[model samples]
Target: MNADQVLQTIKDEKISFIDFWFVDIFGELHNVGMPSYAIDKNSFVNGLEKLDASSIVGFKSVNNSDMILMPDPTSFKILPSDYDPGNRKNARIFCDLYDGSTDESSRYNRDSRGIAYKASKKLKEFGFTHTNWGPEIEFFVFDTINVYPSPYAATHSYGGSGYSIESKESPWAKGNVSTAIDIKEGYYPSQPKDTLEGFRKDVCDDLYNYFGIRIEAEHHEVATSGQCEINLEYDEMIQMADHVIGVKNLVKVKAKRKNKVATFMPKPIFGDNASAMHTHQSLWNGKSNVMYDKDDEQAQMSQTGRYYIGGILSHASALCAISNPTTNSYKRLVPGFEAPVNVCWGLGNRSAAIRVPMYNRNQEKSKRLEYRVPDPTANIYLLEAALLLAGLDGIKNKIDPGDPIEENVYKLSPEKKREYKIGSLPVSLKGALDSLSSDSKFLEDVFTKDFLDVYSELKYKEYVAFAQTPTAWEVSMYADA
Candidate 1:
């Protein structure tokens, strides 16, 4: 749809409010709404000039904070009636940030969406038309959530901070513990135990009906405590990112309407499976799958595919800075929760960082690489862009991604690991940031040096703050000492 068509639709559908949506550097969605009467064809071209970039994290300073939101007509969607229980109809469109301070008003250097656009264009320079990304988004739904240091804590003498979460599907639910799922056994349980089945269905319906984002599948994940995974159909990079943001917002809103809380945090609970956005990616050129090879019997993976995996493995440590951006994210990357801790690639091996699915090896289109390092906390645009750039670098240099590791990486002995040249990912957010500082040349194409520096600085502050703060577990372990 073009700008003219968007305007026509506004009048035809009687859209009362048009919301312009965009994301910050951290991938958090933000929007600005305007009355439909105020919209015109010029509004699409000139953009909504009301955003102050200074207030947004990792954006411009206050003195030069002016920004513009150029709405993408292709992303226009009429929201469901549940969005606003009134007579007014609401519609949303994704926007690209531009500099409103200068006369030219070029695209903002730090705009995550703009960076994604640049990344997609860069693929053509490497002889590939585009890339497809399918993210297996995982999150947790809890009956109730409470956090310490509440808004009224300043009036009291509270010295500690913590959080508590409850889920009816967990073994610790208040009533009907018999139906609660056991630890690490929540995969595909039937109706009595899988309480959120209907809720997931509702979310999927909203995604397709209202937002036009297709969900391939939805099911309970490998955690007993209300963990769920929703697989999105593969689409172009930018569109997929938009779908991700919309899906997350819809899930949270629907959960709240049902008197529940939803979180995409990687490690919301202890001693159980954690949420991860295991992404499946493939490069294509005019309907041809460039990652497939009929001659290769081992994995049926083309040389291009191997180089792409090589690039990801080479930059896996630094990529984690964007892929897993939170302090809590590192907790989920540990060995026990089926998360990828080692840097290697294998066919049908979940322990390796990259897995080549062997489900339909004969089908050329099914050939793709599944990156297991990222979680839902990541900025999808930035993460996908970084992954594409890294893979492109590998192709440019023809980097050889060594042999595949078929065995379980976690069970491998130290000697075996060394022999296989399997390296572990950064253990903490600080480590990932430090790695990015040195190994970020591959990302300089799309993510400018200034952008990377700003991102790293903000993330570093978060890591330091988390490091200095004492947790409940720490207090319990050493309070007597």
Candidate 2:
């Protein structure tokens, strides 16, 4: 769908208002509201409007501060929301950020969705079209939370943030016992034990109704304390990013109203499973799944598919900088609890970075690879585009991944695993950044040097801030020594 279809749908539906959506560098959502009268197709597609880029986090600068929002008509959705103008009445379109002048500077340089768009366009130049992505975002809903730590706090105390949670370490510092849901018991556990089925229901309903996303499923994950996963239909690279940004916004708002807070932090607790956004991907060749070759013996996998997986795993270390891009993200990448620890692929294996679903309903297109390293904290657009390009590069160059292992990778005989070329991803933020700095050609092309400079500076600051913090663990380990 193009801008013309966008205006026609609104006019035909008698849509009252339009929300032009965009994201900042930090993957936060922002919008521009417009009256129906300003719904010009060409103008929307060209991204003609005045806005300040400096306001976006990490995109801060005083000099070249111009930005514009160009609507993506295909992303038009009529949501069931308080903000929604009565069912199908208020419509919204995801937009591309551009410069105000002719030869529009990419307005979305700082936007993940924009970066994905740029990357997808670049792929077409190399004779590939349709960059596809499917992100499985996981999050936790808590009854309450109340702890804030700085560089100097002695015990990271928080006895008075209100909203009592039965299992938190904050108020009494008893450290999550009793009220915490049992480990691994939360998956599909019924109403009373799962507790947040209402919220999960509400989230799925709101997402589907508001965003027009046909959620494939919503279920309680293995993590305790209300961990959940809401998956939507696969979408193209850029729009899927927009949907992701929108999902986060709607989830937070709805969660707040329910007298709770939601977080996608990879690890919010110790000794329990952490949240992960395992991304599932497959290429298409005009209505066919290119990843599946029904005639092949290895899970009906195609050679092109093997190359795609190869490229992704080869770049696995560098990819983590973007896929698992936060300090807390490493907390979830640890061994055990279903977290992927090494760069490996196998048939129906969860221990490897990529897992192929074992039991499909005898469908060919259902074939896909699940990249298990990503967390919900990532900018979906950039993460997906990067993986797609890596895979495309592998396909273009026929990068072989050797062979797929069927053994339990985590428990593999140490020497045997090494012999098979298995390796671990970066264990720290600094390491990921360093890896990205080296294997950065793909990322650099999508995000210009301007973006790279700003992003690196900001991420390093975050790392330093984390490094400077005085944690209870540090003091406990060193106070007496």
Candidate 3:
């Protein structure tokens, strides 16, 4: 909007505060509010103002503390009614962090978002203008969660008392028998079977009406109890990152009101489905979709598209260090259940890490590859941006990610697996960190020495904390001796 247009909208809509939002490396959001009196269309459209730097996550010290926030108008969205149901309505705008004085690219120094920005800029520079992304963000709802350091009951759960276990009033609670899939299972149960449908729809409706995040769809995931998936339309590189932060906040808030707790943690429970944010991506230029070929005999993917998959598959191990940054993320990627343990591309196959969606035959816009490795806990900015860069690198090199494994990769013989040249992801957090330590030149400009240093240090500390502790399994088997 122009200066007058924005200013008038503020007046006409009676929006009280302009909430400037930005995220840190860990997907934490920080906001600065500006009263309507202080903003004009021109000022708000370009950027509202600046903010302090050292206050956010992954910072080293205060000596070199400086940052600026320049708002992106396209991200304009109204805040929830609860945030401001009165005269002053709340709203959000994604921001670009800049150096306070020197224009020396303070953004380049910040860890995740900055790197993603650079990668997107590079994508544009290389004639790949449209890097669209659709992430199937999954989450779980719980009754309550409490943490304690004491050794006696370090791990515990107490959700049995809730109506979900017995009551048939809701969809989830309807067929929730502990033992068997309700002989009358509610996989896609109606009425009482789909208990959380109303709550899910409300969240989607609010996001669309308030923030303009259009929902593609939402449904009950396989976990049956608390697992759910809500999909939103994909946007450009950075905006999606910003939206990711917003999505988390909304989920937590809305769930809390319904007396439920939400967790994006990859593996929250044993023997239950874990949450994943599998992303589907494709590139386009103007009206032409670059990833699509109207006629193709092999896998029906364009040459550029195939190479892009190759780059991602080759770099998959290294990408996990950032894309699947959390320690718990490993618990979700293990070989078994439904997670993608094998690195390969398959046509319409879910077992492989990458798959071309079966639904996209003639649809021009839907042509894309779904990358299944990422979980809900990823740092969307850095992770998504890194995937783009790696794929672009593959495009540049014309990296041929040979032959799709159509058969069940899990059932493939050892020699057959090797013949196809597929590799497994790191088994632990330390392994992923080690992989990233050397192979990540793509992140050099943004993840400079200091950034990686701090990240590695923090992760290593976490590893040591877990490593030093004794597990119940160890005690059960060894303590008897």
How would you encode candidate 3's per-residue C-alpha lDDT over 50-119 as one tens digit per residue?
A: 5556677576357766555676666777788645536468767777766653253444366466777777
Clashing pairs in 1: none
Pairs in steric clash, model 2: 79-210, 97-107, 98-107
- Residue 193 of model 1, lDDT score: 90
Quality of model 3 by C-alpha lDDT: 0.74
Structural RMSD, model 1 = 1.8
User: TM-score for all predictions?
Assistant: 0.97, 0.88, 0.88
Instruction: Give the TM-score comparing model 2 with the true structure, all chains together.
Output: 0.88
Task: Name every residue pair that clashes in candidate 3.
Answer: 3-42, 170-192, 171-192, 171-193, 171-194, 171-195
Tens-digit lDDT string for candidate 2 (371-420): 98899988787787788878877787888987888888888877987899
Off by over 4 Å in 2: 1-17, 34-48, 84-90, 102-108, 122-128, 149-180
lDDT per model, in order?
A: 0.90, 0.75, 0.74
Order of candidates by TM-score, top first? 1, 2, 3
TM-score of 1: 0.97
Candidate 2, position 274, lDDT? 86
Worst lDDT run of 10 residues, candidate 2, spans 160-169
